[model samples]
Target: MNPAVKSLADRIEALLPQTQCTKCGFNGCRPYAEAMASGEAPCNRCPPGGAEGIVRLAAVLGAEPLPLDPERGSEQPRAVARIDESLCIGCTLCIQACPVDAIAGAAKQMHTVIPDWCTGCDLCVAPCPVDCIDMVPVTGERTGWAAWSQAQADAAHARFLARNARLVREREENDARLAAKAAAKLAAVQAEAPENDAERAAQERKRAIIQAAIERARQKQQAAQPRNTENVSAAVQAQIDAAEARRARAGLTRPGSDQNANTDPEEK
Candidate 1:
């Protein structure tokens, strides 16, 4: 985006509810604001902003104020998620689904919502298997921007960004660990000397499989590494292509090559 457009998007984003909710048909408020700044999305998609929010957005964009799009959702009092501990099944699906890290618990353990942290995005409700989660209205009779504040929105946006960064870091760490283990296994296998041609072929096959796994893990880790820009370097792309070819070859190896080699001719 150009500087002017980016500035406009910043302003538009600042005026949003920062719910990180997907109700606007976009991934989050930032994306929706960018779309509006670029004229891709209309200003009335945010139900959290309600009519007043639409007016604010329209004033910013020099467009006529429009009513909230009912297709997105109707404006309602500010709400927060509540988990019924009695009915809770201890699944962590809600925790993973929460965009702002509002839900807290472990696998096979009852989860609780941190009301202060919750943006009431209604993101966690759908993922609950036991249907223990509920959206309880907090600001009764106060809906839309009237029920929300800029400070709350800013805090929610910060938490949403932090959660995303943490998830990426966790994934990259896991991929690194997997790649390390595969590399160690490959080295150990290579250290052993085959007694004969059959054993040598089997060892080679095992090494190939391990190498392919390591390559995949490396690629995954690289992709998980957050960057300001995208696109793999030419050298890295070439390495990936080579690894893919090796993986394909490993898959195409005769299914029973090792067994066939070991079996006696009479048994065959």
Candidate 2:
């Protein structure tokens, strides 16, 4: 490149958004800068740079007014590159796409975005196989534009740390809130649990009493029957006796005995 064009290239680079978004039909800000300096490309080629870029370039080259290139993207408010961690495959496509080397990671490794260096050009969005890259608007406590711009490359780095810290604090607070809610729910359920042991014991005793009454009634009916009918009762008794014998051999219980024994004849 000629020295005059190189000087002009430097001036053009200063006016660019430096996002390397490729809306200007070039690989990065520098490439666009070189093209503009050579007069081969127009000043309106950069959408990220917008009208300001056109004005700056026209001033540098003493050229006439030109409309922005319609093929390039429209100028919208500034935003930054964001990685959708869940969808990101870590292919490093975005890393290669960045003009300022704003993305960091090895091949096949989870990639992180360098927010400070990101120009929000949307260049990295298309290259991602997983489509994990997005351009998200910057939010938080507001600061002056001049302060943000003048801070140089290092300022971008500091902003990144601040953003991360805010996110971590938010997550921690949310986790604590959820944990407290779960603990409170558990405590409430425990408080409502069955508390009266005497009631439960009474129900069990009533069940046993009913069972005994049924057995006694059956025995009484058998005893009242005629001798011919006694054969059926005898067979039933034999089955009961066999079952009892098996239980006794197994040491499960004494034959023909209940743990809550009926001592009185009426009870039996």
Candidate 3:
């Protein structure tokens, strides 16, 4: 950027209300100022600065003052955010959305506004999960710069710059962490890949070892259980032989046996 153009942009930025509200269709007051300095944007887009803001910008840029575009929004009284303590869900959305870090609280805890730090940008209003926030009018009919002082605007601008710096730093840190994690994941996937036949064979051998272990375990279990041989004692075998002989003789007694011992002799 040319030094002349940068100087002109700084002048335009100084004329701004420093709300950093982005009501000018740009990201912030500095962007709108730069756009105006470069002849890309009109000098009357800021609603927070109102008519006086346009005049200040036009003086700096050597252009005629224009009315604030109604499409953007009309100049209104300075307002501050008020949270209904009872209705607050403590979502912390407002805290994250606050460009000035004006809202203070943790998640699941009630948030309160720092009146001195609040820029009244209304950026936090939309992000509230619960309809607990109210934009209360602080300066009744005192609109534009009259409702806001130069000291207040300067302080707000300082806070806005700090907030933007903090956001950039955090984003860079988060991106670095994500990149590291992705690299680690890629390395892990590569490590798990089989580089050659040797690696694949090693894996196969490990599987075989596990399978052999399972088979051995099964055999050991079978060996540990009792098994009946089904062999009868000598006395029991003798009894069986005698029974079979008697059946074969058809109720006839043995040759040396007493007649009284064989009760079925009558049948023979």
Top TM-score: which candidate number?
Answer: 1
The total of clashing pairs for model 1 equals: 0
| Model 1 lDDT at residue 86 | 98
Q: Evaluated with lDDT, which candidate comes out highest? A: 1
Q: Which runs of model 1 end up more than 4 angstroms from their true locations?
A: 225-268
User: Candidate 3, 127: how far from true, in Å?
Assistant: 2.0
Computed on alpha carbons, the lDDT of every model, listed in order, comes to 0.76, 0.57, 0.70
Question: How far out, in Å, is residue 100 in model 1?
Answer: 0.6
lDDT of 2 by residue, 169-262 (tens): 4444543444454455445544453559976576566556645554654564345422111122354345434534543464431111211132
TM-score-best of 1 and 2: 1
Clashing pairs in 3: none
Q: What lDDT tens digits, residue by residue, belong to model 1 across residues 17-51?
A: 98988899998887898899999999999989888
- Candidate 1's displacement at residue 95, Å, is 0.3
lDDT of 2: 0.57
Taking all chains together, the TM-score of candidate 2 against the true structure is 0.50
